[model samples]
Target: MYKDFGPTKAVTDMTLELKRGVVTGLVGENGSGKSTISSMISGVYPPTKGTMTYKGQPYSPKSVLDARKQGIQYLTQEQGTIDGMTVAENMFLGEEESLGKKGIVNIKKINARSAEILKENGLENVIPTKMVDDYSFEERKMIETARALSHQPEILIIDETTTALSQKGRDRIYEIIAEQKAKGTAVLIISHDLDEVKHLCDEVVVMRDGIYINTLTGGDIEPHNIRQNMIGREIDGSYYRADYECSYDEEVVLEVRNLSVSGIFEDISFELHKGEILGIGGLSECGMHELLKTVYGALKPSSGSVILKKNGVQLKNTTVSVKNKIAYIPKDRDKESLFQATSIKDNIVTAALDKLKKGFIITPSSERKMADKEAANIEVKMRDIEQQVRDLSGGNKQKVVIAKWMANDSRLFIMDCPTRGIDVGVKEKIYKLMNRLKNEGIAILMVSEEMMELIGMADRIITMKDGKLSKEFERSAGLTESTIISAIV
Candidate 1:
């Protein structure tokens, strides 16, 4: 398969095969054409070159709905549910004829059938009549999964779905995949989580720079080997920081006092010291995600305050936060961090607009220079800085997000799942960057669900459970995954 978007070739001469009764894992760095190939297969886009065959027959789909009618389903990384639509309406969106009679829709039968499907998939709490926007991100993703499975697709493509899900949600998806395999369905899964790929896939194909690099099977399906193949180089043994000593300053730079966000989190109080990486670990609904938003002033807290002290001056709310050198990299990078339709240069210079201003007016040359400097510093791979951010890969988009904050010279960084969908090569770069920032006396507050990451990179770890701080662990040689897992559960 070959796919091109204007001047950029997303995929070139990529060929692969999926077998029924087995899961085929597609592993690649961001912008590696993994999602592009999947999109072509699911009829989201027609290939610019080459042809596709299904069950030994020529296949060309005009649209995603057309592909679905032929038993092909694709669950994308982005939220696929329509905001105002109900669960039943989204599930049988285009295939409503099955639930209606003679040009008339039967809402009652649709709801009844949708409820049965949701119940079968262990989503008992989700009502078929309720609007999808009323549910959480995880719940909405489950609904998408349920909808895809409802068609009993012969070929199912899942693209980076597990990164947005918690362990419980992932387990449910794993069960569904297993059930599908038992039913002789061909599964094509794309994920940056190497461990997940190894666990769920029978064969793994690595792609880089829009081409296939290697295919791993049997004993070759190891995380280290997969990383090596994906990046076409050997990765360092130590992916995170190795320093065990406490180098943080004694003075607290930011303080959250009795922070409460209605029913999300209650009485959440914590202190971040200068030059420290404070890691927050918890389940999906444990309020850590909301806490990041409240601290950044994106969401208003019901009680308490988030205060940043610098040079004896107090800072609160987003305006002051930005002015005082505070930066936030949200969990939903696509929706919250980067403007999809804008250029990379525009996104990078967005936060640092004040720096690019000459007197009362903004200078385009100065903005371009600043954006170019930061983009080069982060090594963002792009044809040009003027390229649209939406056209770049997930990893490159994230680099642009980080470069924007770096350009602003942020002192205190609030990062939520900073490395969520990035590959190992990019992850190493981020960890090194964090270490460099720490050495410069910049404080970082990291919120992530990865236990190994917290244990490896955090100077101090705080675990939350059910909207409250469950336990705290200082970085030491003795810190283990089980020690943190106990608190998270």
Candidate 2:
């Protein structure tokens, strides 16, 4: 199959088969045509060349519904559930007629079915009648998973979905995939985590630069070999920091005192030192995300304050946070971080408005210069800075989010799941960038669900449980995930 996105070739000469009752994994770097192939197979776009055969018959779907009718279901990388709609509405979005009689829809029937599907998928906590906006992001992702599984598809394609989920959510997805495989359904997964591929895939396919590389089975599906095939180079066993010391300056750059948000998190207090990478980790419902938001001034705390040492005033809002040189990279990248409808240049310039202003005027040439310099520094792949941010892949979009803050010369960063939904190569770049920030006396407060990420990047790890602090671990060569897991669970 061949697919072209305007002037760029997304997929070229790619040919593969999804065998019945087998789970196949697709591993590739961002923009390596992994999503493109899945999109083509799931009928989001038609291939420019080559044919697809399903059940030994010519299969060409003109739309997603056509593919769905043919028993193909795809769970997208981005948020699939729509806001302002009930869970039942999103689950039966295109098939509402099936729940209706004589042009009138049966609301109770739709809710009942949606509830049953959620229960079957171990998401009984979610209320089907509630609007999708009422649920947290992780819950919404699980709802999307349940919607895909409710179809009883002949072929299932999940694209980078697990990275956005918590460990519990990911385990549920693994169980669902196993169930589909047992039911003789062909399954395809596109993921950047090699460990997940090794866990779930029966056979793994590698792609690079829109071309098929090789397939691995059994022992050949290990990380080192997969990394080599994906990037055409050898990566060291330890891609994280070389040092194993808990080192940071004595100065407290930011301080949170008795922070509380009703029903979310309560009485959270911590000090982030200059040149420190303070990691917060816990289950998805632990309120660590809300803690980060409160500290960044995105959410007002019920009773307590976030203070910067440079200016002794408390941060009351996002404007004050930015003015105090604080940058926040949200977990929901597409929705919270980037301006999806705008160009990369514009997004970058938005962060550095004050810096680029000249006597109450900001010029386009200055914007272009700052945007170009930061985008290139981060190695964002694009035709140019003028390209829309939505056009870039997950990894590049994250780079832009970081680049904008870099353009602003922010002294403190509050990142929630900084490397979520990103490829390993890009993750390495971000890790390196974090280290650079630390060396320059900048502080980072990172919140992540991935235990390994906190273990690898943070100088000190703080664990949260049930809306409160559970434990704190200092960085050491002996620090392990088991130690942290005990605190989280």
Candidate 3:
């Protein structure tokens, strides 16, 4: 398949085959055309050249609905559910004709049917009559999956869906994929997570710069080999921090005491030491993300307090958090971090507005200089600081986000899934940057889903389960994935 966006070739002459009863993993860096290929196959976009054959016949779909009618469904990376609509409404969005007569919809019957489907798929608590917006992110993901499975698709394209899911949700998806394989349904999974791809896929196809590089099967489908093929180079063994000793100061920089967010998280108390990389690991819905917000004072906790002591002053709210030089790197960088339509200069200078002011007015020259310095510090690859961040690749955009904090010279950092969709090469740079910040006595509270990352980077790891701290592991050579998984599950 070939696809081009004006002068740029998004995908080039990529020939591939998905065998029946097999799960083919697509591994690549962001902007490498993995999602593009999956989107093309699911009829989200039309290929500029090349043809696709299904069941030994020419297959060309005009739209997503057209593809779904032919037993092909795609679960996109972003949230697929409509906000105002009910679960039943979102489930049968395009295929509403089956539940309606002469344009008159049968809401009660359709909802009943939807409820049944939800119950069967282990989503009993999700009411079909309730609006999708009322549900959690993980719940909405399950709804999208249920909708896809409703089509009884012969070919399923799951694009980076597991990243947003908790352990229970991911296990459900695995079960669905296993069942689909048993039914001889072909599955194509696009993921940055090599461990997930290795565990679920029968074969792995590596892509780079919109071109197919290599394919691995059986014994060749290992994490190191897949990483090498995807990036076209061998990564160093010490990609993460090599030292196991705790390098943090004994003095507490930030303290959370008996913090409770109603039903989300209860009595969550922890102390972050100066220069510490305090890692928070949990399932997606374990309230870790919410805890980050609460600590930042974005979400008001029902009880207890978040106290950030910096420069002998205490931070009590969002305003205080900002004034005290605390920075936040949210999980959704596109929505929370970068201004998509704005220039890279604007993004970098956003957090450092006070520093950019010349007398009474904020000078353009000051902004440019600050942006340039921080961008250079983080090694952000862009044409110029004037370039719109939306035009940059995922890694570059992320660098721009981090550059803002660097410009602010933040003392405390709260990062949630900082390297979620980032490629291995960029991940290494971010890891190095985090270590550098720790050495500079900047306390960091990192909330992440990747187990290996926590083990490799953290001075102390705290595992949350059912809105509570389940286990805590100090940095040591004896830390293992199995030990962490036991606490998580």
RMSD of each: 1.6, 1.5, 2.8
Model-by-model lDDT, in order?
0.90, 0.91, 0.87
Residue clash pairs of candidate 3 = none
lDDT of 3 by residue, 1-489 (tens): 898876668789797899889999998877677877888888887999999998999988999989999999898666788889989999998878788899888888799889888888888998888989898777898899988887678999998887777778888888999999999999999887888888999999999988999989999999999999988889878789989897789989998899999989999999999999999998787899999999998889999888765455545577777777899998878767788999999999998888777688997888998999999988886768988887666677889989998898888999998887777878989999999999998899999888889999999999999999999999999999899979977
Candidate 2 residue-wise lDDT, 305-331, digit = tens = 998987797888999888878899999
Return whichever of 1 and 3 wins on TM-score. Answer: 1
lDDT over C-alpha atoms for residue 368 of model 1: 84
Candidate order (TM-score): 2, 1, 3
lDDT of 1 by residue, 123-186 (tens): 8899999998899888999999988887798999999998999999989889988999999999
Candidates 1 and 3 compared: the better one by lDDT is 1
What TM-score does model 1 achieve against the real structure? Answer: 0.96
On a 0 to 100 scale, what is the lDDT of residue 120 in model 3? 81
Q: Give candidate 1's error at residue 299 in angstroms.
A: 1.8
Better of 2 and 3 by lDDT: 2
Please list the residue runs of candidate 3 whose C-alpha ends up more than 4 Å from where it truly belongs after superposition. Answer: 283-285, 311-314, 338-349, 359-397, 485-489
Estimated TM-score for each candidate: 0.96, 0.97, 0.90
Candidate 3 residue 335 C-alpha distance from true site, Å = 4.4
